[model samples]
Target: MHKFGVWAPKAQKMSLCWREQVLAMNGPNHRGWWTLEVQEATCGDRYAFLLDDDSTPYPDPRSLRQPEGVHGLSEIYSHGGFEWHDQLWRGSPKTGAIIYELHIGTFSTEGTFDGAIPHLKYLADLGITHVEVMPVAAWAGKQGWGYDSVSLFATHEHYGGPDGFKRFVDACHATGLSVILDVVYNHFGPVGNYTGKFGPYLNENRKTPWGDAVNLDQEGSDEVRRFFVDNAIMWLKDYHCDGLRFDAVHAFLDLSAVHFMEQLSTEVERLGATVGKEFYLIAESDLNDPRVVRPREANGYGMDAQWSDDFHHALIAVLYSPKEGESGYYSDFGTIADLHKSLKHAYVYDGQYSGHRKRRHGRPTDGLSAHHFIHFDQNHDQVGNRGWGERFEHLVGTDAAKLSIGIVLLAPYTPMLFMGEEWASSTPFLYFADHEDEEMRRLVAEGRKNEFAAFGFGGDVPNPEHEKTFLDSKLKWDEQEEGNHGDFLAWTKALIKLRRSHVCFNDGDTHHLHVFSDERARTLVMEREEARVVVNFGDQPFAFALLEGEQLELASRAEVSVREGYLDVPPMTLAVLLSTSEQFENRQVEARARA
Candidate 1:
């Protein structure tokens, strides 16, 4: 016999309908929890619960796996059935990790978890240690970015559902790669959400961009908080994921003492201890608060890391300068000083005035490791939300594009690469959704075009609701084998190799960053620690003054130099230099360690 239980506090009565049998249930303590025993209901049995006076049955809110999609019946799944081979996998920590973020639907033509497996070897070859997939929870449509997730516990059916996810993760572990899943807990998708109809899952007392916020701190919220917290633990325990990237945490407008994030973190850590595995949580917050990543011992939320938008904005703004058109958030950060502070310190507006927010924002992250921040030049949000969904190469030239990639991989922080960014793919990552409602489709299309107009890119805004727009966003994998795309792939591969081979580029070090710009000389020099990166960001050849004892470790093969103390950096090229003494000493240390 199988025992089933569900929490439906508001319902007067509940019944479990299992394979042509209706089992009546009642709670002993008025908690509204109903339980039933079934002889034939083992794993893979279809089931649903009927509330008092409701004709339509509802899927279990805590369903383990929904192979039939969210709108269909829930399935009884045995989490222990799958064989795991990662017994010795201790997991890689956030420190010194290179994260590559991807969306399953558009990442490959198959648009399923199984389709993503073949690309794992490619990511591993690029020296990526972790793969951060965007939210895969079952949403309203057949195609989406996964942010519009309605079912927190179920994987999207179109992406081959739960079993397919298991295969994908298994492949990742086999290749020694950690998986980080992006999760959205602040709000539900706008469609196919039936939680509010059953109980008070939403709080009208607070509001967010997606309408009412989750009922985290409001009345009848005990079970509600448990509902979300249990979902978080499910991903870590049942799925064996290494970490979670919480999306838009600022939307969680909770005034409670404990806060939802702290409660979730505590539960995740407890689950990690039980399984003898390491689990982490990373937050995406626009508030720029240090408290987000601060440890619980210091009276902070204790999240592992966070996406640093300040670093991205500073880097992109400086690289794609003439930011008058369509740069949006990149417009306010077009300066060498912005890039300097972001590199040395994590935040650019630490207690300083932010022109974007028009207020004093952020706090100093003193004594914090660079591992606490994840840096990137391009991400899903940066490209998709734009008018044309252009990638970095679309905005900047080849040399500058390569320069941005070099800086991100070499910077002293956890780095992230968006899908298709490695080869400078031409496909735009646009905001597309398969909303069946015509009214919603029109609203999304018009809203997107109007939003871009405010940023001065209105004339050529593509209609987001068009089928062609969505089709245009899918990557053409054939491009990876030919022309500039092939060259970019080779360049990125070399950079990743250099990063993995050098300890100086690893996380957790603060070196003074100095950027020397000479407009007439057409050269820029960036010095960090014992190494210096010289770039010719102009049209003419420029000579760099190497320190007396400096030795050229690596330079763009296009560069030419006659002497040790002097080198000519060709226009639009990059070079790396190091002291001969330091290089030889580190080489010997590496050799001894290997021996």
Candidate 2:
């Protein structure tokens, strides 16, 4: 015997259509839940709900398995059936973390969870402590980046389904890497969505840029909110995931006193305690609200961390200078001072008036620790959403790209690297989706083309539906050992090791860091503890010493030396130095002897 339940508030009647056995559902509970226990149904059985006796049936909103795709009947999956080897896997809190983000479909040749497992050791060897995967939730398309998720609970069938995910996670844990699953609860995918038919899953009154906003604050919103909160708990507890990265949390609209994010965080914490695991939640937010990561006791949402897109923007503007014309949002960035501000204060526009936004943006995060911010130079959205999906390596060239990696890894905040970024893969991470319907495909393709019109960079955007787009995005994994790619990979590995080796990389005391930059000289000086990282963003060779005479430690391009009280940094180059007078004197003496 098995139990099946669904929330169908609008349905006058609900029936469970088992394999050739249709059983009428019982009364709707006070919460609008209809449940049925079937003696004949067991694991592996396929079933769906007949809403209001309509001929068309809808899959379970919280389906564990969707073997027949998003529109087909849901399968009865036994969650704990797989044999697990990671019994002693007590996940990490991931402090001062090194995070690597990968899209399962394009990470390797196989494009499945199982395919990704073989490379876990490779990532672990790279000194990455955590792997933040893009959303795995099943969608209508055969392949995608996994942002548009319809079935939030089920792993995409194309990625080897639920069991395969467990195996992949187990493998990762075995390889000393924690797993952070990216989840989308802000909105469901556009096509093959039947949750709207089940109940008021969407708020028609509130609209987001994507579509109808999720109903988190309206009438009968409790159940709808529970559906997503419970989904978070499912991933953390049942799947043994270490953490979750919430996608586009700003898109969630809630006028209610208690926000849905707070409710979800409360439930997830409770589950994490019960399961005895170190679970965390990170958010991709544009709201710039410190309350998102502040403690719940302090009247905040209590997310563990949030992505710092502003950091990426500021760094890109500095690294890829000589801009043609400012794009939509990039117009707001591109200043050496902006990068310096981001390094010292976590955000450049911390409640300051913006010329681009035409209003004050972002709240001060001075109270929070540096670990609350996840800093990265490259991510999926920054690259794939572009017209041609060119990586930073292509945009700024190799040397600048290498310098950017060093800055991100050594920064006080947690650092993340996009897949293949370390290796400098030749392929691009283009926007692609496999939609079966031509009309829907055309609509999506057209929407993507116009998305960047405001940004002058959106020239001749490719058809996202074209087969070549997805094929071109796949990473050339073998390039890890090839030519310049190998050199870049080695450089990244060294940066990660250096970060782990130094106490200066500790993200706890962000208040102590200092950033000084020369806009005209196009040079930056980052000071933390006894170490200083100097960067020259301009095309001309730059030479200067902030503290009269400093000792060169590690140079990105070559062995650095202080000539005439200035460390000569070549064009698009960088160098690490010792700020202590004693260490500087010792290194100076050694350099003179060698010369």
Top lDDT prediction, candidate number: 2
lDDT of 1 by residue, 1-595 (tens): 6788887778887888888777787662465567877777798898888888787888877776667667678888777888887777767766779999999988888879998899899888788999999999988767888888888888898898877888888889889899999998898888777787567888987889878899988876888888888888877777878899999999987888998888888888888888888786899988888888888888778898899999999878766764366566665576766776788888988898877677898889887778889999999998887778989889887778887887788777788999999999989998888777899888877877878787776576777667677678888888996888888888888878877776667746774455566655555676665667777767687778766557776655455574756887777777787765576467557769999
lDDT of 2 by residue, 474-512 (tens): 998877788998888888887887788777887557776
- Stretch of 10 with least lDDT, candidate 2: 321-330
Candidate 1, pairs of clashing residues: none
The local distance difference test score of each candidate is 0.81, 0.86
Off by over 4 Å in 1: 28-32, 322-327, 460-467, 511-526, 536-541, 560-564, 570-572, 581-595
Q: What is the alpha-carbon lDDT for the whole of candidate 2? A: 0.86
TM-score of each: 0.92, 0.95
Q: Tell me, by TM-score, which candidate is best.
A: 2
